[model samples]
Target: MPVLPQVLALLFVVTWGVGAALLTSVSQLSPSGYDFIIIGGGTAGSVLANRLSENPQTKVLVIEAGIRLVSHLKSIPVPDMTCNSSEDIQDVKIPFLATSLPSTSVDWNFTTTDQTGLNNRSIKLARGFVLGGSSSINFMTWNRCSNDYWDSLATASNDSIWTWPAVEYYYLRTSTLVPPSDGHNTTGQIIPEVHGQDGPVQVSLPGHATELDQRVVDSAFILGGRFTYNEDFNAGKSIGLGYVQNAIGNGTRSSAATGYLLPIVDRCNVDVIISTRVTKISGSLSASEIDTVEIAQSANGTPTKIKAKKEVLLSAGVMGTPQLLSLSGIGPKGVLSDLGIDVIVDAPAVGANLVDHPLVANYFTVNSNNTWDPILRNSTLFADVLEDWEIKRQGLFVDTPGNTQGYFKLPTYPGGVDPSTGPLSANTEVIFANGFAPFGPMSFPDSGSYMSVLAAVVSPTSRGTVIINSTDPFAAPVIDLGILSTEFDIVAMIQVIKDIQTIVATSPWEGYVTGIYGDLANATTDDELTEFIRNNAVTVNHAVGTAKIGEVVDSHLNVIGVSGLRVIDASILHTIPECHPQAIVYTVAERMAALIKHQYGI
Candidate 1:
């Protein structure tokens, strides 16, 4: 059993387990009118709930589709496994273990419509429907994008509030850095003093490192690259190779629920409802201003209406927020008409600016003497690591496999401009993952990819739109990710693939391992590389910018043309950032909560 459950079980045993259940039941039943109604109690909603309810007089209600937070096998911190394990990925569809709850039960199992690029296959999108949202299921990489990415948004939106310095304060306030222990070498660093020491989230380096990781780092340096050690990647600059700080602490995933929600669950002013889905957000027009939101609850296989006194906040993430907006007659005119819902706010931009990073994976077979082979072959090592995590909160299970990630501009993207300057080359990001595996356990190769790395092009200018197909709340949306429609995206990926090839060819592995898939190592032509990428690219699963900020909503995160409604999740990102988005979502939620408090004087 995990440490948390053991602690809870010990406490439960002391109180006979009856008091624990009774307290939980009592907290669920005790409810009153809230000043704010937050939909989707995940990453952003949890922060909003905790911060807004800080005022003793203010009431906050957070509605989630999953149950209360619990520590199980899936949620336990295991450093050896990536967040995208067979168990985690397969859990989205199965319903056997407490960890393997059905995706339809707690996750909005959404899929994109067929893409014209990449053989026209619809991709499965798994957005968490649980209380902690995607943060609960995401790889706990605590990386923030470059400052220029946010400054560009501020310039594009004509709003200075989105500037880097303005948002940096929030990022600093939310994170607490774990001080480096004895014998840890953290040199040539720019550590910031403003980082919180008593914050809810715990950010730290991995406790263990495999020798394969060291070889990959050395190889990068040998290939004419510079490596810098960073104590906090959230300090507004992420452009080097280093151990990635994660959102895990003391052998448990520090989800927003664990960091923010669990501490405030017993508060009188906070109400969290699980297994409740918000079907629609209805409003009336009074002298050109919207008034009152009519909320429908999914009860007993039917929809029931409820009213909110103040405002409705949608943190249902990139996919679900737009779906809810379209269902409530607040999207494109054509889309709303097709769904048979009358258009109230003809926000043509709603669900229009969809952006995501597409990753091209490269694999290498390592020598038997390589460090990674032992972990792959030894089941006893794996079990021992798990046991160590359970007992001592130390082992391979607590560390991210993607220990050293590089955020650098490709030589072709000098001065932040793609060599092929077109629609698809805007604000690109090249994420280099070391010692990682793209496929899961069943597909684990014998001599697996030694230092596998994926180069993800983030903040792509390629924009797609997600549309509603039916009036049914449970029906999946038509997500058309118009990937690689522009020539610039193809050029960028070709350059990235070439770059990875150069690293692999020049690395120490040249003597030990064969090339990528045998006989394909020395292909130098751009056409060959482009074709190889087209046949092998997969999504990094970092989808964002669906219901984009400033286009579909106002600066305060409110949906334009509709009062008493706002979206406070990844859907509000005006553009995709150059890194993983979990930390930003958490910051956005914290800021949103403050905005709400200031607006209502709560």
Candidate 2:
């Protein structure tokens, strides 16, 4: 009925009423033209928007498929300033509480194709569809990949830039390291030299870790006696028992949208259009460059074409990038033909090489009163916990829930041979959460409090694909998350479970543990464990390698057959890292920004 354009601090906000129709006119464009048109204003895209738009003359526009949640650094939602109710927006700012939020709003909620390895069961693939992307919804752990993982990428693409020495610079550039509160270096857990002081994103430890955390770390040392105590994994190596760092600051989630985009929203050259999905790139099939992008605010709304003068950067993440490329006819010939779409690049590797860590959750009941479940289970204590966080930015709410994490190599079994490759570089990641079923709603049994330890296979050999299911641009992609598909991976998982059981059964941990649950609880032998694994396998939610470097794109992240079009997100990773992929994604985006700046001499 009316058009309202409210411009404040260079931000142009456009609001629409319920059931508003798309403008009949063509999509509007700036006269000077944007130097970069970034799709999906998520983690990487948000960083690009901030870095590329630093020069006032350089114009950048970010088209996001989800809502814009941050406007200013102060306005960004924090755990303490947010809500006590899980139904409220503040729930997202709380690290552990975020996982319990419904997927209807911010998550794409895509499921995998029936995983043949796991008894033909389709697993839920919860990808963030909101601004800041998965960083906004993921567990706040900020562990980086192992040096070997980077070396593997360098070898895969035949590029030395992917090596640790080169890539670590980008990691430093993306983060503003927060040292452990107590100033001393060796005495405290965190290492200061490994961190950068001046950067955009903030990296900090949990505000309030529980006593159970220390016990877990001590237990891990007892279980894996061979590995050294690595206080900081982000420094380079990730093979030891230590406190897992998180993307948090002052008891709040420091998401990409909050850290990178919000503080610089006042830049005159940067434009962010949220709640808009880019359907396809309307460019020549034979041509090497992009012409324009087709996008719609609503699913059924009319698609509008907007020109991209310089380049179109696809930072839409692992799932979105591959799906968008295929929708634009830049994928396998057979897949394009099946969907009746014109073949643009015939890049068979576009959606192939999909890899993700397979996780098996282990639950334990605590014999002591040290568990966090009782406080969470009691209404009055829980209310006090919420109030303490909201008022003082302290208490259990400030923690990431999982206080201690251990990364270790699988021990060589007695009378058993190891993989031909020899000792692996940290294959298993064990996270010890304080309370029972922290992955789900804060629930507990009437009998006793519980703790959860998730043993996840970090370096999986199984590969799968993310292919288009239909010609409809908005349709969900078919994701075959081939987790634990190989016998090698299954064997590794079995060993990791055995290690967890051993750790739980040891001195301090053994004294605290009263019972066990899930796959291992009922199983005694390896045969029973294998069946339990097949039945309980789940993703760690670290999906990558769909459109990888050297295959779908070059070493520099340029799409193989297209110019003025680049894929610079998790999709460009040669393989899923042995740790969380968020830090790697941030580093990639930082490097991409530097490369683009150098290319344009900006």
- lDDT string, candidate 1, 68-127, tens digits: 544344433222232222332222110111122323334466667777766665565656
> Which structure among the candidates has the greatest TM-score?
2
Worst 10 residues of 1 by lDDT: 7-16
Best by lDDT: 2
Per-residue accuracy of model 2 over 1-602 as CA lDDT, tens digit each: 00111212122222222221212223544556578889988889989988998888888888888765632212212222111122233255655565543354567778888887788877777677767888887887887677777778788889898887888888888887774322224335677678767888788876675767677667656655644566788767788878878888767777888788777667778777777888998564445578678888777989877777678899988888989999898999998999898887899998898999888877887766766666654555555665676567677767677877877776664336432222435778888877665332122455566788888888778899998888777788888887778877888788888877777776867567788854467887888888888877788789999888998889888888888899989988877788888988988899889999999887
TM-score of candidate 1 versus the correct structure, residues matched by position: 0.84
What lDDT score is found at residue 406 in candidate 1?
Answer: 58
lDDT of 2 at 337: 91
Clashing pairs in 1: 42-132, 78-397, 78-398, 79-396, 79-397, 79-398, 79-399, 80-396, 80-397
